[model samples]
Target chain A: MTIADQVTGTPIAGTADTAVRAKTAAPAITLPVVGERELRLDLFRGMALWLIFIDHLPPNLLTWFTIRNYGFSDATEIFIFISGYTAAFVYGRAMLESGFVIATARILRRVWQIYVAHVFLFTIFLAEISYVATRFENPLYTEEMGIMDFLKQPDVTIVQALLLRFRPVNMDVLPLYIVLMLALPLILWLMKWRPDVSLGLSVLLYVVTWQFDLYFSAYPNGFWAFNPLAWQLLFVFGAWCALGGAKRMSRILASPVTMWIAIAYLVASFYVTMTWYVPQLGHFMPKRIEQWMYPIDKTDLDVLRFTHFLALAALTVRFLPRTWPGLRSPWLRPLILCGQHSLEIFCLGVFLAFAGHFILAEVSGGPVMHALISLSGILIMWGMAWLISWYKSEADKSGSKTKNAVSNADMAGGG
Target chain B: MKAKVLLSLILLCGCVAASSARAEDAVPAGPPACEVPAYLLTTESQLPKTAEIIRDNKPLEILVIGSRSTAIPSSEDSSYPARLQAILKEKLPSEPVHVSVEIQSKKTAEEAASGFVKLMEAKKPTLVIWQTGTVDAIRSIDPDEFRSAVTDGVSALQQAGADVVLMNLQYSPRTETMMSVPPYLDNMRVVAQEHEIPLFDRFAIMRQWNDQGQFDLFNPTRGSELAKQVHDCLGRALAQFVIDAAHVGPAQQQN
Candidate 1:
């Protein structure tokens, strides 16, 4: 098999090889594309996703200290870049070690994951709306809830709500993630397993998105809430850096130059976010940005929100410790272990959030009760995560024992 | 842990107190609880000035009556009457004076004066202001009654040894259909010249805003175009009237 055809265990490996090797020269910094395999990047991806969850929650006590409302809460922007970054890291490595076939399959799998996540979150959002509409006391309870009455239709307006809600400005991002994952494997394959070609396309996607507003978009309705297409280039750049492939970039990061730059960025983000961006919190305080941030408006991502998120994310990467603090400590090991199995943690978090909302949310109380409510929410989530991890560990141990027993029986039968 | 909790509690209380204190300062105090003064102001600087120059050396008690919160005060300090009081305080501090105003809605000049009979009796004020006639239009109380009420109210004050300044009332362009008193503002000059009461024509101020682009002297919008014009006009009028009246010397300064 030609270099591209030497497939790995995963089907997308060949294509992953091609994508990782592709390259594009950007003036700011050089990042060598890592072959498709970096678990640390996964940790970042998971962290970004987690931040998004917290960001989505209504601002109250826990979120207050968070730079969330500030311009720097660009946690969402980091998710997009990391999404692309991992694609090149994983898919490119797969392609080089294995083949295009493995790369393609893995790409589809990632895409499917995004679609599932979207559907799940969308349903959760819709369910919350229904709960509020039905349960809340609207004084105008009788006025022809005419159009609003459609909210009563069980799942009737689900499709329309998805389209019309226009939330997550930068529409269809969840779906976009899936589609990009699918297409990326091929894009990687076509790059002839070269870093330049893969990265060049990613940069091109970013440029088109940033300057030209290129996304599958409507006038305003379909503006991409998270312009992954544009942000993908940053991922490609970071991937290059992680692999130690971008020679010029590696030198810069090693030099004192990057340290100062990172420091300056950190200070600037803090200043702008606290002083300038605080007041703008009231702008998003109202629940109105829902209409265009969803569906498929890829073109209309908010420039303000996107740029701020990117700046903050970059600063964090440039400065925050590579490994989480206290992660190796025995007392804190459980939490880091949970992080290792993030999908399980996510599922448990969702379940816990729902249960807490249903059980404790209606109990009306002021700040004291609210503090308790939030406290319970955090504790409940952690509890569920611990339980799930424990169950998984037990099940795996049992499965290993059963497998060993069957193997011994087979050997005895042959004797 | 208890100490920490107590510290937190102290911090929380401090925050609450600070926020509330700031809010209180943010809004300037409104009219006092009782026996408040209403504003007296002129709409235009060019208009003739009227000040109830005290002759017998009694403190001038000025009262302004109005329709609503937004109604024109004689001046910006709520009424030109108050400004008159301020000037009196500055120029004649030892004159044993107290200037007071009361704003009332739905009262005719006679009604306003009659209500103040006890106050007039108590304060024995030497200066009276009759701001009515708009209500006369609203009630369509007889025009003759309006004229007589003005006369009677003024006579009542003067009989009590107080001089009077009448503020003629006008309708906003808003009240064409509701008013039945035949727009008394139009005929105020007749009453003032006939009664020989120094009528501060607030009506003229409205006319200036409508005709000459001179804004409402008491725009009430606080520094809005209307408010600025009223403030300017009333201040100038109060200043000029006081100066002119001073020239007449304290003896001839009567209603």
Candidate 2:
């Protein structure tokens, strides 16, 4: 029987049901039920996108409200982890149903799509910065956005951009994501064959990269801002959890000891991060120890940052279980919508951040202006998400209508 | 006979010295041959530890900490830090010099300063070249807060036994028109002065270059080549500025 029949306690007649029954009867590899969309992923991912928008505004007062102020990790970590989780959820299903080769193709196609989106975003971002610079007769914007190279050698820079080696400011993350997605097929294959070995390999790479200072180099000079070698550990860990790791840890997850540890870590991280804002308290640590602890290399996904994110994740999972109806509440609908259309919203956010910076600079960038710009930018993102959702719904409706018409005609002809 | 011999020798020596003076005068002094541009130099006090390191022929370590600008691209070796190392190596070939960069990544002076101790511990550079104030200026951060942050950062660097050279905001025509940079620049100067550390006047130097048409700041088509040239010049100027601050010359040693 089909999932729909099982859910509604009614028979769904036709060849589809019969095929599902035949498949179920054979039963060595039972198809997993595709359940309701995970509201928590959408909710949190949306929250991360918003935080990114606010934080990108630079000198804004509202940045204090973002997750960065309270922890070593920030929105980037959240966004990336969620991406890994969702990718596994979607692609894992495809592999189970459509088989390995098709799943690999699907993953590769996604990589291409993300790469295209990244290029498109880069073009628009560069154009926006260039246009603003020209309009104001200030070449500094080009310099500020790290586009002087492109202006100097468009031919070479364009080639580098296509290669994902030349990225402007706020444009680095997409490249990192692209690299991670490129490896998704292998990651999934490993997870399917040997889950523990896959995770072990990911961790090994993370440690090796951090220890040896290994990273992919950007064009001209320097290394990728978000080192993929280090970051892939988190992404892989997220996927592992989505596949079955979380289920294996159910006892530990439910344990009070684990809960307390997670809470304590979060609290301590919160205090330490706050001290960075308040110098008097910040200086309480010994210079030697502080120095050793600091400059926690964000590029390499330093161990402290990794642990902090883990603690935050643990607490989040504990408090907000999968059954938490609060995720589906009207109050969080905007976040859910944005999360659903994450790639589009993220690209839009990058543009809006530049616009916000421009507005803050051009207009009175006081607190009021900061607030206004932030609100407006977020509203625009929400609007874009809503529009995308609307378009998708309309297309789906059209598709269903056509299918229904074809079926009706077939029925009549058969009768 | 002895008096006559002495007078002849003295007369010969005087004539030889006079001819040498005339030869020196005939050679033109072109713009004081300033390896480091005058505009980029400030009257801040010397870097004692840095000088000692250079004078001892020990390795001179410089840590360049700033935003995206800290890592401007042309080639791996073209970054200001790499160029600075090359220039320093050329100037003090006997001394092993290494310049490393730590990107603050869109952080303000306050945020960047918070990580000084960590950077110092990891790199343990003798001299910390802080390129700051741009993000703060753009964000319109409070001058007092900016000053405090800079002061704290300098103090932290010093406490870690590293000499500090505060590099001020870069002059970008676009940024200049958009935000008032004076407050942040002035605050950095105040902090540097209070801390008795050298302040590399990147703003004044870039502005001078732009104003004097040394570099085409207004060129709509200014490309990576110009960026390379600017960074190269900056690297050379900064190397000289550090060398001067560390009191590396014979004149400084005599003083």
Q: Which candidate comes out best when scored by TM-score?
A: 2
What would the per-residue lDDT of candidate 1 be over residues A50-72, giving only the tens digit for each residue? 44444333223544433443333
**Predicted model 1 interface RMSD:** 26.1
Q: What is candidate 1's DockQ?
A: 0.02
Q: What is the docking quality class of candidate 1?
A: incorrect
Q: What is candidate 2's DockQ? A: 0.03
Error of 2 at A186 (Å): 0.3
lDDT of 2 by residue, A122-171 (tens): 78766765665555433233335342324668788789989998776577
TM-score of 1: 0.48
Clashing pairs in 2: A152-B223, A152-B224, A291-B117
Give the residue spans of candidate 2 off by over 4 A: A1-33, A132-149, A400-415, B1-164, B168-255
